[model samples]
Target: MPVDAPMPGSYGVRIPPWLAAEQATLPARITDRTERMRMVNRIAARNVEEGTGGPFAALVLDSDTGDVVSAGVNLVLSANVASAHAEVVALSLAQTRVGDWNLGTDPARPRALVGNAQPCVMCLGTLIWSGVKALDFSVPGFEVERITGFDEGPVPADWREQLEKRGIAVDTGLLQEECSTVLEDFRSRVAAGTITLYNGG
Candidate 1:
């Protein structure tokens, strides 16, 4: 390899046109936690049908007002990027929208990240660094691995404490049955050779 081999300078993932249109139809604010989780679950299920990526979707929301800041689905397969998980995409979009990398900068208007499933190891680090004040998820990592065969990596046993120590609130098992149903459906599709199962080392 040479220094001037005309290497690619940059790369990025864009939300699919369909997902963007769906986002446009979302209400300006969703105050109910159950409703938030329901939306994420629906998006995650649709991601599999859309053949975008794995069964996952996430959102960045104003914790206080429940205003949706950004929505993202797994684009790892479609975007050809391993790091394009739902949580990362949503967080990145939120950062870009606010023009600040640190989401917790505004103390009065804290943010929360809501996802269909628990974050993988890489996304755990992303969440820590993103400065979001809270995390809400529907399904656990074990369920994700059991149903989808996707490796979530070795998340720390004290993962909740890790986030709490940094002043990030943690909530889990929101609409677990619904979220797990989505994962189960994705597994069936994969078994039927209709969808690709992506698992990174």
Candidate 2:
């Protein structure tokens, strides 16, 4: 006989209190791409400092008006869920706010997902299925693995081209230095035994 299904609230992710407070105080619109990325980097660094999760954060924004649709940080360690990566949380939150799963259904008003670092293989799949039109990120997956000692999985060699082929604009190297700094700090903390590096078996 098949086992009973798990309870509805047994597993779920949540935006940590610090991140929620910051999200509430964001401006109505950002307008500048650099500024948008800067915010993401800051959030990533703060996530490490707060010991909520890994040094990663993401935002879903209205590509046209620069309105922040939703913000999310990696909640894997905090929520005890493996799939709580920043990209997944951000995209899921965006879908919830708009009352639809397809974020790019309207071509005119597309949404963009911005992150402090490149998505791992799992998150890459989530980004494609989430219907976001554009992806902007800083720090390459290889560099992230090198700095933080987390397995990013086998991201495709031509991941950018694949996204482009699917009509998703890929913008890399946004605030690279600043983003790398956050990852480096996380590494330092992990070395000091102050942060837990959660990697799959």
Candidate 3:
């Protein structure tokens, strides 16, 4: 496995686990702060019913063999995920982003810049929902720098500044720079040698 790649069966959390739980159960009936939360939960529920696990994962069709390369959640179990709306958003994001293919429709095509950007929101929401015990977004890897507001520092300095600037009191512990799991896909690519290694030790 590439040293920089995430370990097998690990997924990082970009947000708080409890907060994600909150987002998972957003009130569908009330029209207020929980609207987005409700949407996320709905998506999760549908993912379970449909038997399409990895609501946070995306499929990448290998241009060479038409094989599917999955990144993010391995399977989006409906039981694990409890919202239909959230499933829509997550699946949509995965289809549109992640993996070697950049085009949402064609997984074989590789558009590193745009395609890589697709997993941001889903990843964030998943980590929250999964109760990610740890996480690490710092360090430049796999187009990580291209993310506008992400950083490798101990704290999400950029996210903090933006929230504070907007007068939003950021109270989530998930924001702190802590090491955590990154799902099994990260290791699968390495064992398969799909992800290339560069730079120096």
Please write out the lDDT profile of model 1 over residues 81-186, one tens digit for every residue. Answer: 9999999999999999999999999899999999999999999999999999999998999888888889999899999999999999999998999899999998
Q: What's the CA error at residue 185 for candidate 1, in Å?
A: 0.7
Q: Which ten residues in a row have the lowest lDDT in candidate 2?
A: 2-11
- Estimate, for each residue in 1-201, the C-alpha lDDT of model 2 and write its tens digit: 976976576667888899989998988788899999999999988899899999999999988899999999998999989999999999999999999999999999999999999999999999999999999999999899888899999889999999999999988898999999999999999899998899720
Model 1 ranges off by over 4 Å: 1-6
* Model 2 ranges with Cα > 4 A deviation: 1-10
- Root-mean-square deviation of Cα positions for candidate 3 versus the true structure, in angstroms: 16.9
Candidate 3 lDDT, 1-201, residue by residue in tens: 559856769432232243345434533233222222223333323322333432222222232333322222223232233232222333333444443112323433421111112224434343333221222222222233232222212324364354345332322222111111221333343346543222110
TM-score of 1: 0.96
Question: What lDDT score goes with residue 179 in model 3?
Answer: 10
CA RMSD of all predictions? 2.1, 2.8, 16.9
Candidate number of the best lDDT: 1
* lDDT score for residue 78 of model 2: 93
Lowest-sum lDDT 10-residue window in model 3: 174-183
- Displacement of residue 2 (Cα, Å) in model 2 is 17
- Which one wins on TM-score? 1
